[model samples]
Target chain A: MTPQPTAASSPRPVLYSFYRSSCAWRVRLALNLKNIPFDTRPINLLAEQNKTPEYKAIQPFGAVPAFLEANSQGPALVESVAILEYLDETRPELPLLPKDPASRAKVRALVEAIAMDIQPIGSMRILKYIGKDKEAEWTSHFLKEGFSALEKMLEKTAGKYSFGDSVTMADLLLVPQFYNGIRFNIDMSAYPIMSRINSELETIPAFQASHPTKQPDCPPELR
Target chain B: MTPQPTAASSPRPVLYSFYRSSCAWRVRLALNLKNIPFDTRPINLLAEQNKTPEYKAIQPFGAVPAFLEANSQGPALVESVAILEYLDETRPELPLLPKDPASRAKVRALVEAIAMDIQPIGSMRILKYIGKDKEAEWTSHFLKEGFSALEKMLEKTAGKYSFGDSVTMADLLLVPQFYNGIRFNIDMSAYPIMSRINSELETIPAFQASHPTKQPDCPPELR
Candidate 1:
């Protein structure tokens, strides 16, 4: 059965997450920023736990960061940005999206730049497809290409945070991507605008607490 | 300067588009579906025209489907889905997003399935990165995998179009991706729900009018 279109509501939301999954991290950051308390159902991608049938029930795509609310019984939502948008629309308090339509569009454009263009290259499936020895090379090439482009966009939209300082959803996607860049050893300093925003974001407790190393499944050594 | 986040406003919006770019096609479909009149500034991706400095002034990332409204002067919105969302918010007459939060999330989920996971694989840059000899193998591998997973999601949400009877944004995204699948020779019949939806959508004037083959820049042979 397809997961029902249940937005965030009642009880607590459950996030089926993996520690290092950047997509999952985006949702975690959104949840934290909204100050919405949530339970984390750790799915260890390194262990391939996401591929199992039980996990598949929640996310047919078998990806990390599937979310369920209201019933929590079934019908979880897949895709990070979808879950992010749901929380913003339902919660209303933290207001991850800006009020004006134009600002909102700019925020979303930044969100997609990372979510669609950058994050996919470093995705587990894509990285695996890229294969062992050359994975980093493949990721670096694409990440840098995307980052360079995003830096240009950020230069226009950024003001303390992506799309101004209020900490919109764009920042949620950006921080995790920056974190991944650190992991891949991409020269973070090269993109001054993104680096500045990421640095500013790191200081926030929500961003810090929601980090990959802080997740339930994050191994202690990495933590 | 960053493109102003001015939502779609006064003056007929101008869409910087290319005939065959699936990303651009998504915006064209949104405009058509909303019955919003628009002007198309053709950016020929095949001719490498998107690389020109004139285009870069509007879209620093230098992609097609950059959008400008209000003054028709500056600060265009880049990213197809962002442009789609902008129009939905501004032109509420057609109502591209569903009402309830959950349904909206579901629609966005299907959108991301194609936008993030599927569409990027068939993108010009990715295919070019894969190089000529292996581009087909690479694209077909990811598209089929994504379609297989998306088909599972559709079984639950689809009614007439994706996310029930309404022609939501998901249909806008799905139509173009399905078209690209045809280009790659991916088997459409394997995903019955998607195939049915695509067939139904083709019967709609908006979808038909927005076809890549019908765009101004489309060559006669392709048309």
Candidate 2:
């Protein structure tokens, strides 16, 4: 079932996230897509505040997107897919995985290809580690390789979404990758299948709402 | 169902894999754990053979660990998680996910925390791009942070396996990171929880079987 919509007096879920983090953004998109309203607690990575003992208690990894469960099991959690899956399970009305095993596996694989292979190579943390000039080349190389692979996989399974008309967790993944690509200046047209799916994803309120520029923590000037 | 044991005459599953690749190793561990036999078609990352048109056709991104599915409705897929998830689905006797959603999310998150954050930062490919000396520092830094987070998470969820006693997908992920730790000479003792899990994982036939030294593609001297 979909999450209940946030109202004026209701307590919203707390999302410990940063605007630039693709992982955090994925959760935001999932929550939005599922219509779950949450307050954002920006963790400033640049300042290294995430490393403080206080924040470390909340997110040991010092990463953004440690989700605080509204009223259930435990405290906040780290990792995007885990959070998304948690949301999917707790609210089953808008399903993220297919009923069958094969389809679910296919969808999860498509998402991981981007999450594991592509995004990690080009993330800002890695980019900073690589330095400025080489960052573009590094990102371009990964995007080129990853998009090509993604294209072939998408061609095999494309319908209205990454696996069919229904938007599964795969779609939640693709949109963020698309945004990362644009930031790196990789031409989306290079992969037609990705472009088409991305185009379709743009129309959905969940994706549109979760865009980096739209996040509450986004620099007002940048937004 | 767990995959049926292979026979000498059985057509082995074709794995596009590379040595020293955590992602590829995840699948390898799963296959070995399940007692499914497989043949390796090594994708030489150093020579960039994975980028060749022929290889790209099999895996568009040219990432290693693409499984050659002979009878599946969908084409051969890439991504370690997808492959592992697919294996779990097709062979349900040895389930990778917990029956409950919260536990499953915790397990998946543990895997992703390593896969997405820790493993990617020190990727051999990325390291090569950054040069040798600097790569080690970056690798150590990233791994330490990721592992520390994992240690805490594991403490909360530990039993015999990463999540309780069962060897779910999270254990598949842990073994490779341990390998990476060994590669970098990072002290495992730093994280007591991880060391405990590592000790437990090594005893399992599946994890031991899929190690880099056992892979057909590993250099004889290294093996």
The candidate maximizing DockQ is 1
Question: How much DockQ does model 2 earn?
Answer: 0.46
Q: Give per-residue CA lDDT, model 1, range A135-194, as digits (tens).
A: 878988998999998998888888989987789999988988998898899999999999
Residues B1-223 of candidate 1: C-alpha lDDT, one tens digit per residue: 6544433454778888998888999999988888878888888888889887767666666778898875655578889898889999988988888899888998999999999988887789888888999988998899999999888889888999888998999998898899889899988999999999999999999999999888888999989
Report how far residue B41 has shifted in candidate 1, in Å.
0.6
| lDDT of each residue in A1-223, candidate 2, tens digit only | 1122232232567888888888888899889888887888888787777778777766667778887776533456678888887898888878888898767878888888878878877776667767897777888887887787788778777897789889999988898888888888999898888898889989987787888888877889998
The local distance difference test score of each candidate is: 0.86, 0.79
Quote the lDDT for B163 in model 1: 83
- For each of the candidates, the C-alpha root-mean-square deviation to the true structure, in angstroms, is 2.8, 5.7
Window of ten residues with lowest summed lDDT in model 2 chain A: A1-10
- Interface Cα RMSD for all candidates? 1.7, 7.8
Candidate 2, residues B53-150: lDDT per residue as tens digits?
77766666667777865443325567788888888877777788899877888899888988887887777666776787677787788788778888
